[model samples]
Each structure stands twice: as structure tokens, then as C-alpha cells.
Target: MNEEVGSLHERLARLEQLLTAAQRKPAEPAWRRPTSRESRWAVSAAVLGAVALQLLLPERLAFHPEWLLPALELLLLVLLFPGPRARKRRTTSLLRGGGLTLAGTVSVANGWSAVLLIRGLVRGSEGSDARTLLTAAAAIWLTNVIVFALWYWEWDRGGPVARAEGIADYPDFLFPQMQSRELTQADWEPAFADYLYVSFTNATAFSPTDTMPLSRWAKLLMGVQALISLLILALVVARSVNIFGG
Candidate 1:
């Protein structure tokens, strides 16, 4: 009886050791690795382009004083860029928060401009000059592309940093290169410019082209972008054409 009790205690101790070892093991990553991180230069240039585009919009279509939104966007960019080398996690969260804030600000301003443009057209209050109307519509269309591109860049695979870290097991957008290792390098991953191209293509085609949206949010965003692009083309561009013809 004494020998049996000792053996039982030994087995229990071994089981506990196994359990502890299992708990200490790190989780295995489900996806391929060695993803190259994207540079911030492209993103910064895109944001600056958005700011310039906002400035091109008509005064009535822009925020009061016309420069207010641009100034705010510039300020956010100034604060958000130059991410710290240390304190990586905290700085990443801060940068993401600031990036989303900047993107949201631009989205709101552009949305406001879109709404006002549509309202003015419906109410017949917008200027009748074809050139000015066309220019403004073009600016809005270009801004729309940049805004959606920013969203895609920031959201795909839990943002750029997350992608670089290979934290996400899957991607939100499926580029052709991701489908096959033969198409590109083993370390190939979507970058900000890729998202921008996707946005531009989606806006032009009013649908996904080569790249496909794999997530619900991606599909919804593309749908909204299509709707807005359609509205700008159908209403604003059409009105400008009619004015020119008249």
C-alpha cells in the first residue's frame, strides 16, 4: 500500500510538470513569415496629397475658412509621424490612434463636402461655371481615392505594423501575389501603394479588379466607395457636362 501511494504521487508530479511545460510553450504561427515592413514615406506622401486636394475644393464645399481641416490634418501628421524606436508597442498604439484620427478627420471633411455638393446641385445653388465645377468634382474624386486607400492601408491585416510582425494569420485583402508564391518573392506582402492601387481601381471600375476583399469590412468599404464615386460621376460630372454643352 505504501509503494502504490508513492507511485501515484510521482505520476501526479509528472503530469503537473507536463502541464506547466505545455503552458510555457509559445503558440505556433499559422502563416508564412519574413514579411517586409512598408516604409512610411508612401503613407506620408499620400496624406500630404490629400491635404493638397482638400485645399483645391471650393470654399463652400470645404470647412469654414477652407484651411481649417487641412491645418488639423497637417498637425496630426506632424505629431503622428516619427514613431519612436523604443517602447514599440506603446508607440505603435499611439501611432495607430493618431493615424485613425487623421484619416477620420479627412473622411469627415470629404463626406461633408460630398453632402454639400450633392445638396447644392439638387437645390441649384452651386455655381454654373463648368470649369470650376469640373475641377471641384475631380478634386473630390481624387480625394475619395486617397481616403479609401488610407483606410485599406490602416485596416488590412491589423494595420501595417501588425502585418510586418506577422500577427495576423490571414489578410483582409487578397492580392494576386498572395495567392501564389510563384508570382512574387516569398516575403511579398501588400503595401500602402498596393492598397492605393486597389482603391484607384475600385473607384474607376466601381468594383474589385485583380485584388479581392476577403473581409466583411473590406467589402462594405468598397461598396461605399463605389457608391460615392458613382454619385460624383453621375451627378457632378453629368451636371458639368450639361453646363458645358449649354
Candidate 2:
């Protein structure tokens, strides 16, 4: 019975130590831990979806050479590679640049596609299948979501690799949970999913919700995202509905 009591006391003491350490540096979310799996999954899924969407789009809607964007994106993804461990200085710099470039390219491509889709709808569908047109709009909008998600993930306090290394000491966004101490644990670094959720909500609501953009760049990016999403939803979606005579 004495041994059991002693063990319980030790466990409580260790817990207290950990909590104290965490509180000492609550600002550094990545304080003492390595990058987690959520970051990896988020980026990998974005790349896969972007490539798939490129293939699924109509040849006319895709760039002049349908395979070019996908090939280039695949090459960039390969360049970053995102291996299991930290990379050398030069290599890490290249990977970071390549990742951001790929994300920007994805955003531009999807935005252009949305524009083209809107043009087609306005030009008159005539005998074009309404369902097919609607499908294209949906695909473009979804690609927009993925592209912006990547942007948020990449630009928020530098990229994932930077955050993992505890390099970026500042935040580009101020989430509600961050302001409330009781809301989340000390080790809660914003994951890719958190940014993805931010993008998703921004697209859906056409404005910032709980997460406030702190930097000028973040504000601009969120504004652009909201505008593009509004165009796709208001113009493309509404046009599709009109075509169906609803």
C-alpha cells in the first residue's frame, strides 16, 4: 500500500513539472516536440488532389498542354520530397521555395480555370449538358479550396519544415483557441488541418470567421480567397442554376 501511494505521488509530481515547463513557453507551440503526422498528411493530400483535379478537368479548361501543369507539379513535389528528417541548409531552402511555388502555381491555375468556366457559362451553353457544366464548376471550386489551404499552410508562420525546426517565432494568424488558455493544451501547434479548416470556412462564408489574419500578407491572401470564392459561388453556381431554369 505504501509503494502504491509513493508511485501515485511521483506521477503527480512529474505531471506538474511538465505543465510548468509548458507554461514557461506557451508562445512556442512546437516547444519541445518534432513535427507531427498531421502536417504530412495535409500537404500530401493537397498535392494528390491538385494533380487529380488537373487530370479530371476538360482538356480545353486545362492549360494549352494538359499534362504540363501536372508534370511540373509532380516535379516540384519531388523536389521538396519532404523526407522523414531535417535537411541541410541549402536543401531545406530549396524545398521551402519549391513548395511555396507549387502552391502558388496551383492557386493560379485553379483561379484561371474558374474564370474560364464562368466565361463559358456566360457565353451560352446552348446544347451543353447542365449537369456537366455544374460538375466543372464544383471541381474548380473544390480545387480553389485545396489551393488556398496550401497557401495558408505554407505561409502561416513560414512553412511546415520551418515550424518543425522552431524557426518561425511569430504567427500570421490569431485563432480563437490561441487567445483562450483553457481552450487548448500548450503543445498545440496549428496543424495543416487547422489551416485547411480556415481556408474552407473562408471559402464558405466569404470572410474570416474565428481566425483573424494578423499580417498584411495574410489579410491580402484571405481577401483574395474570399473574392475568388464569391465569384465561383455567385457567378458560376448561379449561372448553372439559371441554365437549369430553376
Question: Which candidate number would show the highest TM-score if scored against the true structure?
Answer: 1
Give the per-residue lDDT of model 1 (tens digit) for 1-246: 999999999999999999999889675433446465667888889999989988988888997878788999999988877863433788889988888998899898888898888888778787498778888888888999999999999999888888878888777898888777686877787888999999999999999999999999999999999999998888886677677788
Top model number, lDDT: 1
- Candidate 1, superposed: residue stretches over 4 Å from native: 1-34, 84-87
Name the TM-score of candidate 2: 0.79
> Which pairs of residues collide in candidate 2?
none
- lDDT by residue (1-246, candidate 2, tens digit) is 999999999999999999999878444353325555233655777787888887788766777677777888888777666653556788767777888889977876777677777777667642177677667777888888889888888887777766666666567888877787577875567787788889999999988999999999999999998998887677765676676785
- Where does model 2 exceed 4 Å of error? 1-39, 125-127
* Residue 15 accuracy (lDDT) in model 1: 100
**Candidate 1 — worst ten consecutive residues by lDDT sum?**
27-36
State the C-alpha lDDT per candidate: 0.86, 0.76
TM-score of every candidate relative to the true structure:
0.84, 0.79
RMSD of 1: 7.5
